[model samples]
Target: MLTNDRIVLKILKNNKRRPLSAYDILDKFLRIKRIQPATVYRSLKNLLEQNLVHRINQSNKYIVSSENSHENDVTTIVVCEKCNDYEEINVNKFKMSLAYNILDLKNFDLNDFSVEISSQCKNCKT
Candidate 1:
């Protein structure tokens, strides 16, 4: 991994709850050394390609990929809409087979599957 990629991974590992935007990473990493947005983005792309990180499409932020997440397992991201906090869960293969079964019933070819559920956290609910 590149120095910038390691820096970004460290940031993501430290930040386990809320996701961080590319600019957020750039800002944090900049305190250590000067870097640009494109650099941060490139690091992110590398991390993503390596499956070391996951992107929250809803918020355009990134988080460390769960160690439990595998290539075939489904990654379900539950985000608290109010607080913007998030959690990643790796659904077991049994659940994945069920999904495949459903899709097969429809004659849909399964490739990659991801799910994002939006809800309010306990604190936000009150």
Candidate 2:
């Protein structure tokens, strides 16, 4: 199941910003193999649990997970709603650690590991 999920992740990595929905993936996979949605969902769930993939909230889309810090497991994701362009914000500065500490103090689950801050891109704005 995990290996199959990685196959799905590889597909996702090749197409960033497309934000494929579950049904979309199901339909695609069904054409190649006779797998049920439940099976795919199960695998996806496991992948998510292992932090090998991520789900977009409000949108219900999936994408490959960004590599995180094993030491602190810290990462930040930036998303553009208009274009659906995503970027991984490498938290090199102290501010990221400060915010992480603050958030941990507040006790947010934040399990999915995504930061969906929406704004128009310069191209979109223009």
Candidate 3:
């Protein structure tokens, strides 16, 4: 990993409780270092390719990949719509097999998949 990549990873790790946009990462560094948006983006791309980070597509933000995740683990992300809080759950192998069976029935190959479930979190509930 390059210096910038490490820096980006540190930021994500530090803020694991919430997702952050590229601008968020860039803003954090702007106060201390002279960094460009492109550099932050490049670091994010590389981290994603390496499976060191995961993107919340709905909100266009990124979070650090869980430390306990495995190669075949299916990630189910629960997003709190009201507060934007999110959590990643590792679905068990049985669920994974079910997904594979569905794909097999359709003669489709599965490389990677993400399941996003949006709902109000406990704090947001009435």
Candidate 4:
């Protein structure tokens, strides 16, 4: 049997660009490989520890890391309150946080970067 990380890497490789959730992984395993959710979550936690994936806080979902580490730019997430559907803002097209001028007011150290935006998506706006 392939190791957990390899299994996860294989899944990510197959998806290429699409984000896969822990539940989705569990579902896939149940359908195709018969693995348990706890196992999958453990593998995911391992991946997170290894910096191979990142947790998207807006939707509380996980996505394969685009960069290994030291990821620059803000991870914009858009959440809808009504339908509960959320999405990652098209971060490639815009300078989400690059334009901000960070000035040290009282020497407050800032680390990590992400922007949470809650609004009605196109489908929910109707």
What RMSD, rounded to one decimal, does every model reach?
Answer: 2.4, 3.5, 2.3, 4.9
lDDT of 1 at 72: 69
Rank by TM-score, highest first: 3, 1, 2, 4
Model 2 Cα lDDT, one tens digit per residue, 29-109: 777678878867987898787777777775788877766544345455566778777665545434565675645656665
Q: Model 3: per-residue lDDT, tens digit, 13-94?
A: 9998889999999999687578879999999999998888988888999999998888767777888999888888887655
* Candidate 4 weakest lDDT stretch, 10 residues: 92-101
> What local distance difference test score does each model get?
0.84, 0.68, 0.85, 0.63
Error (Å) of candidate 2 at residue 87 is 1.5
Q: Between which residue pairs do clashes occur in model 1?
A: none
* Model 1 C-alpha lDDT per residue in residues 1-126, reported as the tens digit of each score: 449899999998888886999888888988888887898999999998888988989999999998877676778889999899887889875687686575555665556657788998889898
Q: How would you encode candidate 4's per-residue C-alpha lDDT over 27-97 as one tens digit per residue?
A: 76666576767888898889877657666665566666555234444555566666655565435322543
**Which stretches of candidate 1 lie above 4 Å from their native place?**
100-102, 105-108
Error of 1 at 75 (Å): 0.5
TM-score of 2: 0.74
Task: Identify the candidate with maximal lDDT.
Answer: 3
Off by over 4 Å in 4: 67-126
Clash count, candidate 2? 0
